[model samples]
Target: MNQIDLGGKIVVITGGAGGIGQAIAQRALASGASVCSWDNAPTAAQATAGIASMQVDITSEAAVTAAYADTIAKFGRIDVLVNSAGITGPTLTVQDYPLDAWLKVMAINLTGTFLCSRAVVGGMVQNGYGRIVNMASVAGKEGNPLQSAYSASKAAVIALTKSMGKELAKVDVRVNCIAPAMIESALLDQMPASKRAENLAKIPMGRAGTVDEIAAMALWLASEECSFTTGATFDASGGRATY
Candidate 1:
């Protein structure tokens, strides 16, 4: 819990109502930043002081655009964007996976990231300062069984981070992503019990990571201290990721 100063910064965290997203929002607030959490299903708890919550579907172009406008109206500008909204589609073999489910997963995980990232680029570039930390997964690095859609979508997120990072390389904006193994969060509950156990067993630490650990990494990436690194995937896989 080393201190990272984010004074006077305004952060927008998608999926801010969820476990990991919420943690990041709270951390940012504690770091002296104003936070606006955008989620499709916002919660009462997100009504915390210093945080503005918006019900937004990142998958919709219009919704994303509107959210950006509202955010700008509220905060004047966005300093950080954490694309944490995501889903792990149903657990099933590729042949048994529903087409609709696959599409839905891609829509939320990959397309949503793209839309949100696009929404903030203009403002960030104009301001000459921005930090984008996308939430990817170790599964994206090493494909997991019964998680085809989730894996594929996150892989695309990693690629998108790289592309955006390079596009803004000459600017002060820095784009990066986190590839966490099996973080203990509500999303992990979506996996079958056996599958969860299998994934945890692969980690040398022999335990799932916590929301705080991921939040710490995110907070640093969002800070000025993270300079000199862009288009990179920071691993928080508990020793699960080899490369």
Candidate 2:
């Protein structure tokens, strides 16, 4: 189609303070989109104070609904929503994994996505146009050891993207996801070096992905330029993922 002009558009990005999230926000801002950046804490001032900043708990439907209300009240429309807030549960096998931590990760990475999508769907249906880019991880596809919760949660995200995409296929909202391999972020420090090195070795590209790479994919998915692809997993695995 045409160039992806996010100019004058309104986009809501959860987890906008951290690496990938911050990168996505910067790209969107550069394209001229008014971004509503949400994290568990306060941020967005440095990136661009003009952008909206809100403290959000992704698992809280009430909080999400209120956030959407604020966005609509202020901007009058929601053009895009990016669910990037997530966490990796404790490093342990399924047998030793704590139920509480597992539940928490699932609630945020999976359920939180459900809540935010539900909150935004109405406005999107009303506007007859919307784009959603959910973040899944290569961990979900390859099932890394010591990361059961994170992998499961992201797998659910992939499934949810497909189901939601089909549900809204005729309604003008497009839903898609990116399954990225290990990236250079604070998240990497949580893993043991051996496991991390093993992962890096698998990538034919021989390195971790950068936040800008993921952000660039998000920009296209959020753009009108990305048509005919929905409910699909776009890979940014640095050649690590094989089928």
Candidate 3:
């Protein structure tokens, strides 16, 4: 574990209770940054000494506002924001996809990321330094079969990241996203075994990525060393991403 210096930085990670999110939080703390996790459920047990946990419904504007306010009050400033909150909607063909289910996925995966990013970007712009890392998926780049909602939502996220990154190009506030292939996490449990195998087959590495691997890339993007890149998609898909 090569330590990246994050001293004096304050990071806010959404969906911070999940495996990948928690891994990112752990890395941030290890790098000397204060972390505040925002999630829909309780994740206090995951917090260490320098980390704080807050329950937030990212889909709700009011809840997101209050949560960011609480985070600001506690940390005084948000140096980095990681929009990691998302859900894998049920596996269904677009023709048979449930309208309610599609809406739910969009509400959480896409709109939720937008809400969280909007909440912190103002302060970051004012301060002239910020890093926003949005969690996108390889499925976003290459549309997965029977997962139209999840794929479309993440594709929108990729677009959003590019647009925002370019918008902030001169502001010292970099925005980027990672397009990771299937990762080994609780989220995978949502998929049927056949679906999981089908997804895995696309990865040339023949293995799912670890949370630590994703966290490492995320940490780099959140660091000053990632100075030259913005509005770019970093691939952690193990050759699954074709473009």
lDDT, candidate 2, at 184: 90
lDDT tens per residue, model 3, 141-184: 88999999999999999999999999999999999999999999
lDDT of 2 at 176: 97
Q: List ranges where model 2 is wrong by over 4 Å.
A: 1-3, 44-49
Pairs of colliding residues, candidate 3:
none
TM-score of 2: 0.94
Candidate number achieving the greatest TM-score relative to the actual structure: 1
lDDT tens per residue, model 2, 8-120: 88999988887888888878988889988877875746345566788888799889988888888988998999999888778888999989999999999999988988999
Q: Decide which is better by TM-score, 1 or 3.
A: 1
C-alpha RMSD for every candidate: 0.7, 2.0, 0.9
Model 2, CA-based lDDT: 0.87
The digit string of per-residue lDDT tens for model 1 on 1-243 reads: 698999999999999999899999999999999999999999987895557999999999999999999999988999999999999999999999999999999999999999999999999999999999999999898889899999999999999999999999999999999999989899988989999989999999999999999999999999998899999998999999979
- Model 2: how far residue 22 lies from native, Å: 0.7
In order, what lDDT does every prediction score? 0.95, 0.87, 0.93
Model 2 residue 177 lDDT?
A: 96
